[model samples]
Target: MSTVKEAVDVEVPLHTAYNQWTQFEDFPNFMEGVEEVRQLDDRHNHWTTSIGGVRREFDTEIVDQLPDDRITWRTTDGDTRQRGTVRFESLDDAHTRVELTMDVEPSGLVEKGADALGMIDRRVKGDLRRFKEFIERRGTESGAWRGRVRPGDPGGGLI
Candidate 1:
């Protein structure tokens, strides 16, 4: 497995950064190679990507979520097998740090080669930078979800 860790400090409040992240459908706006993201439910989403000419689709389930703190997910079924977390931390009332950490298991030779070449790390770092710019330009989130979810939750948690 290859692991990636990246972070960017955005010029937005913690709540603003966290809220924008909850809008998974907007990830394609900043994430390279992510073609689309469909929110299947509060804790599940479908993702489509074309990385290095390799196309893939996958479904991920959010295993743990705490508003303004972190959101964690794992692949439930897909062409990719990985787990990741996006963490939100307040630096102050007007600054926030967003950190992403992921463990990806390469499935084939192409993926393994790319992982060894550090393509995943570069992509993740670039993605976080774009996210920072995107959010700073907007100055606010397009939507918000303050729900809480624990591992194994069937999707009904209000705080």
Candidate 2:
């Protein structure tokens, strides 16, 4: 597995940044190579992505979440293997910082080569930069779900 970590500061309030991120189905709006993300439930999602001509479909389950703080998820079934976390930090009332970290498993020769060449790292950084631009331009979140999902919560978001 290889890890990628990146962060960006957005010109938006913490809640605004956090809220926008909760809208998983909207990821394609900012994420490069992401074709679609379907929210299966409060804690599960299906993702379709094509990167460097490689297409993949995957399902992920949120393992932990805290409003305005962090969200963590891992792929459950898919051609891609990954686990990731995104954290939101309030820089001020009008500014926020978002951090993303991921551990990914390369599936085949092409993917492994890309990873070795730092393509995956750069891709993740670009995604965060796009997300920063997206939220800063909108100035408001499309929607939000502030429900909490604690460790061992089974990702139901009942809290």
Candidate 3:
């Protein structure tokens, strides 16, 4: 597995940032490679993405979440496995910093090679940048879900 981490600051409140992120189905609006995200439930989702002519689908389970704070998830069964988390840091009442970290298992040598060449990193960073723009421009969350999990809690948000 390889790990990638990135962050961006947004001109939005922590709750705004966290709440917008909870609206998983809205990812494709900002995530360049995300073709779709269907929230199966509060804690589970089906994801479709295409990057560099490679298309892939996966399901993810939210393992942990905290209101206006953090969310973490992992792929359940798929051609590739990944675990990731997003953390919301309140810079002030009207500004927040969002951080994303991921650990992924490449499907094979070709996938691994692409990742090692920094393509995946660029995509991740680009996605975050788009997210920043999306949220900043909207100035409000697409929607919010009062999840069952709390920031330090586990096995609650992702079904």
Each model's lDDT:
0.92, 0.92, 0.86
Write the candidate numbers in order of decreasing TM-score. Answer: 2, 1, 3
Full-model lDDT, candidate 2? 0.92
Clashing pairs in 3: 43-158, 43-159, 62-158, 66-150, 66-151
What's the TM-score of each model vs. the native? 0.95, 0.96, 0.91
- Candidate 3 lDDT over 18-87, as tens digits, reads 9999999999998887899999987889999886667899999888787877888889877769999999
In candidate 3, stretches whose alpha carbon ends up further than 4 angstroms from where it belongs are 150-159
Q: Candidate 2 or 3, higher TM-score?
A: 2
- Candidate 2 residue lDDT tens string, 70-156: 999888888999988999999999999999999999999999999999999999999999999999889999999999888677543
lDDT for position 1 in model 1 = 75
How many clashes show up per model?
0, 0, 5
Q: Write the per-residue lDDT of candidate 1 for residues 1-159, one digit (tens) a residue.
A: 788999999999999999999999999999999999999988889999998889999988888999999999888888899998999999999999999999999888888998999988999999999999999999989999899889767752222
